[model samples]
Target: MPDADRPQELPARLLTDPEMINACRLRDFARVFRLVKTKAGIYPSMIARRCELTPSRVGEVIAGRRHLLHMDVIERIADGLRIPGHMLGLARRSWETPQALVVTEREAQQPSEPEETPSSLPGPDVDSILAVATRTSLSPATLEAFRSSIEDYWRRDNQHGGEPLRPAIVGQLRHVVELLKEDRPPSIQHGLYGIAAELARLTGWTYFDARQYNQARAYFTEALHLAKEIDDRQFMANVLACMSLQATYQDKPADSLALVTAAQDQARSAIGTTPRVLSMLSMREAFAHATLGSQARTHEAIKEAHRQFERIGQDDPDPAWVSYFDEPKLIVDTGIAHGRLGEAATAEPLIADALRREDHSNQRGRAFHAFWLARTQLDQGKLDQACHTATQALQPASAVASERVSGHLKEFYDQLAPHRQEPVALAFEARLREALPLVSGSTRP
Candidate 1:
């Protein structure tokens, strides 16, 4: 029998590095934590960064004082450290079921208490309102106001990206938290919790797009906790799907696929499974497969996504959160999936068509899609066309505060390294250096 004190040994298959086979096998979160610090030459800050936990929290976990057993947290660590699930006394992760296990209705009831209260975070001023909220009945109109504010912020985020609007959203989140503490009817409380989760998720996604990943992860974790507290399965699935997208952007395709699978499972358990939402999750799976270089799997996921999308009827109860995933999103994402697998010829026209239809107001998204077009051009060895597409991409990229766009530009610069002697390539390289800010190591692709 394996010693209870001993962590299951680290295997060579974990990270696919033969040289790392004999590395630290400590399975305890704390032991693994300390081992990560000691194995600086191998993993460095990969754990803290990829898992979206602060260094201090990782330290606390290593010291055996922090709560590290939550399902989401465990999955984060398992993916980040490339630890096989079996080693952690969990089931195997794969492309099929991935990391999904059904979260039963009984297990998803509202919590008796809030998950974690804010102790040190700065928030909106609500001292006056808090007293009134406790004594008086919560008004439905007031709840409606909060919902409207959140919806407005969502629109703003979609148009402007997250950097410029995060502060306002955070302010709204603080106000909602204050309201949540007020004495109110159970129905009012439920609405408050749902809005709070929505605000938290918005904050997280903005930070994510801005490439402030640790902060983003922290917010997403809070949103997940709130979603669980209220048993809001739809929002739970949405948050998980967003997390999967983040994993994809970070190039952790295996983890991305797992998270998407979990999102799909969560959606299946929701009171009403909307096809729009299911299609979004399936598209995420397709993207993950593409990133992993699985052409067949990518195609399979894409087909499934399309099939679900076709099932959506005119009167389907589509939520506000998923209203953004339309035919345009599908087409663009299909192109992206193919592009990630290096199928430039098959990807370019679809991406180009989507780019033409993309909203002009969404400068960040337009720039992002343009970058993908440039990538496809480069992949096809059309260096001149790539340079031109990249130049057009830089127009909006320069106007945005997103570190992610800058990262893409940086990657494009790397592609130009070989042709630096060519005047067009040299000029674009110089232009990019002057246009975009240098991304920090944490946000670099």
Candidate 2:
């Protein structure tokens, strides 16, 4: 039915192959080229022709002699090959079929992942979805795609910080809002509302990280409204926890404690709640108590957090966002809570051990923890070691644009002012000046 010499659309088998997925995730183009050739029978020349690249360049890529990083080039490959944008860490592409139709149905211009999507594999056949007509309403597959995209958004935010990601996230959030305007079934509406709530909360988090308190509050309020619309208590707990943290940043520990209390209440009866969720809320409680200067309550909350963590079973399913709140994070948060309570001696080792165990791709986390480690060292009066540790932090900070990290550094610098004449402090000063000039919006938060 098709020309033997012609390059057919990539088979779904190749697209869904785990190896190919990993390669794409890593942006290993050389491996991608090889896979396309071996698995899809699309040779280098054909690949080049379809992707609008020179044959030699394609050959070089296949041979592992070249790499592709430019956005324009990446887009061309995606468009030319019909690769789903999520596969490439991109927003859904322009040519993707509308996810849902009103009264009239139309042919789909694209095929996407299935319900639950596997970061999932079992779904309708790719060719059928690629060639089949539209649905009257959004399907579970569509929701899965949205969830997948959101997961990627959070991953990128964790690794790279949120400022660079806000535009795409906001665009998707707006699209989800527009989708809500359509008359959908209650199931679909709730799903859409939950996603919208998450996006709003994430937007608020971005603003919070940037120290834009007013904007953060506005978006957080909007997220709460959306979460309430669906009676999604789990989601509500998550949002309240975010707000609780933000309140602490704003130096309102009493408000933080109240918010965390509400979060704990919501989480208690929330369906499908995981131990990690309970543990995280307790950590939030601990943070609030620490900020309030109640050492006894802080220790009690921290113990509760650990108790909840010990209850975490491997089979305990958590919300994707909660995945970040794992063992290393719990340890670091404990150290941080103690540090906030001015117990530097109790904090330093926990923070240091967690840092060593943290995932390297999480540059922002590394930077944040590194600052705390440095601060604890400084508080223990280890001037030279503290300066050295703080200097090391600049490596991760340089790789991400986070106002929180910058602000913490600024606070540390101010603390070092009395020691400015010392060589270690001067050396740290030179490095800081060279690395960031102290990004202007930085704050103690």
Candidate 3:
């Protein structure tokens, strides 16, 4: 028989991995197959061929449609995937490598540079919210309830990603619109408009994160209109900033720049705007400039953002949404901007530092930043290290359902395709395959 036709041995590290050991112990064939398929580049057909099973049967096992409980079949899987029998609670196979030799070989291949360093790393129920919105009054108390709910939504979006909350957000937004049509005092009327704008913007954000660009744009436009109706420049600036971010993602750097400029103009004209708000706008501008390949402008914008950030005072009334743009966000955004300009060396440390400083509960944010960090590492030719960094991203990414984070992971995987055969790449691929179901099924708006 041709040596190449035989089932290949998996790297020692992969077989020794706690996750792999646990899956094998639990007899989770689906996970086992996925790991083998991903790590070994052994497709379903290859697994079937090696195990003397049908391809459909192997597919069923990987998809959790079938379980291999029979000892014969289990032994076949062990041989087919080259898992050490002891790991699966079976007697050691005749073909198992000698322990001393395995240890020697593992040490020979182990990298001197360790896996990527660690980075470190909320809101509301919907029922009571609807009950309050159902009340037909434009009372200040009602306004405050909606306002508090909006803040909660923003916090939820921060920690959990916005995809799951879109339905409740839309319902609340519609209720706010209905209240807007009723007669009320001038102050209350403006307040209602503000609330409506906030809801519309939150609705847009959920769509944005889901990559539903058209819907996001429409909601953003609605938010802008509501803000305009009350002449609320600050809120209008916030909406425009959101739109600018969408434009950046869409690759329309010029449009992003234009929108951010408009946002800045609004901020300058508005009374009581905080330095943090300006700082956030500047960071957005830096992103646009970076995308445009305008190095000078990007640097200038980033510098200004830092300057504005340093001026933040306790008395300043920063809107709750912009409050998320703190030191870590600022640092990560700067790193991302440099990454866009292909300066991975300059970007890596900032991103890594941001990760360490970032709030652990902001899982979605961590996922996004972690992806950027991995990309920068990849750009710098640190393929193995990059894969390690990316692996760290998966833990947080899994906790929240977010297409934005999923898309980032997808983009990184696509970029890593060229080096697919590398052992570290193979290992990361296996882990990614295990996560594909969750990443691919991220909730959409």
Candidate 4:
């Protein structure tokens, strides 16, 4: 834990041993009490009254000459002043042994650890990325770049992928939104809202990764509502796509299909006005169709998605949330959809490509990608690969606070049970068993 007494800098008040001794004297307690009373705007008599102690006893404590050592008195003083019990204890201890306070004061002035050098810190790449994002107007290319950057961040720290870091990131995004909400231009506010919606979507995805379906649903609902409020049809489509993902994970393929269709309708409505939005919706529609085993419809949807994707030149796409619809991600989703439909062979190459091109920063996406890969490998009888991929997926999934991903892992382990005689399968089963308590305890009531 970080030091509690150390402020950002050292204070100028230096305490000599004699001064410290004098400070610990019984009479000196009155001075301390008076200082606290003045700062808190309360009369010492009033404080004594509240503490159920006479003003004279309170004065005796302040004078450092009070012989009574009742713990209750100490507690009352701490409580009346609203000081933490631990701090109050420390103060009491210091009063008993004045040397301790002197030592503590000395220790507070010294640096306990080596100062971090600038070169040793992570570079300003994220700041640079944000700077670029802020400087440019919304375009398909820029949005894709932003998406790619976020994904790369996830991939770099595989351990943190899929964790509650999504909520933390949302907190940061919310800070930006708050700033934008304060006297920013309309255009800036518009962009900020889009980013907020995107962050909310990511929050939902993170929750889903953790297998917290209800929380995921709430976040997605919020994102969808925000997107609608912003009149950002593309963002709305993205939220819908996530809703489909949530439904699919919950074993509601039919509901997933409906969500995709809704997304597609919204996308089509924005086709002339927002081509990038159309492409995103089309991609989602293709995945939904594939998951539902609508082969011909899936193929047609993919074709349409490709057509729309092709129309979005780097310069032509919308600036917000448009960058996520890339060929690699689309192909990955295609493979996932195929894998769900029991076409492992057809899904393998696409999954491989997605894994290869996946951004490390997008922990949730990478976890899902790995999950689908593991499932496909299992289907193909590549137990070793399947186990390895599943383990990789779990590393990130564990860090994230998402119930959806945990459910996927639960399902994955369930499927692995038939092969429990194998060491890898057995090891995975053990891990899953251990995870059960954590999963059960972490759920929101």
lDDT per residue as tens, model 2, 101-164? 4113211221222225464453546634643455357988888899999888888887778977
**Stretches of model 1 off by over 4 angstroms after superposition:** 1-136, 437-445
TM-score winner between candidates 1 and 2: 1
Q: Judging by TM-score, tell me the better candidate of 1 and 3.
A: 1
**How does model 3 score by TM-score?**
0.69
lDDT scores in order = 0.74, 0.82, 0.83, 0.62
Clashing pairs in 3: 121-360
lDDT of prediction 2 = 0.82
Give candidate 3 regions above 4 Å deviation.
Answer: 1-136, 440-445
The CA root-mean-square deviation of candidate 2, after full C-alpha superposition on the true structure, stands at: 19.1
Model 2: runs farther than 4 Å from truth? 1-136, 437-445
TM-score of 4: 0.55
How far does residue 377 in candidate 1 sit from its true spot (Å)?
0.8
TM-score of each: 0.69, 0.68, 0.69, 0.55
Lowest lDDT 10-mer window, candidate 1?
104-113
Query: Which residue pairs come into collision in candidate 1?
Result: 30-62
The sequence of per-residue lDDT tens digits that candidate 1 reaches over residues 40-149 is: 33243556776778877776776677646333566567656657644443334331132344223221121212346577742334645565566556688989988898
Q: List the residue pairs that clash in candidate 2.
A: 117-120
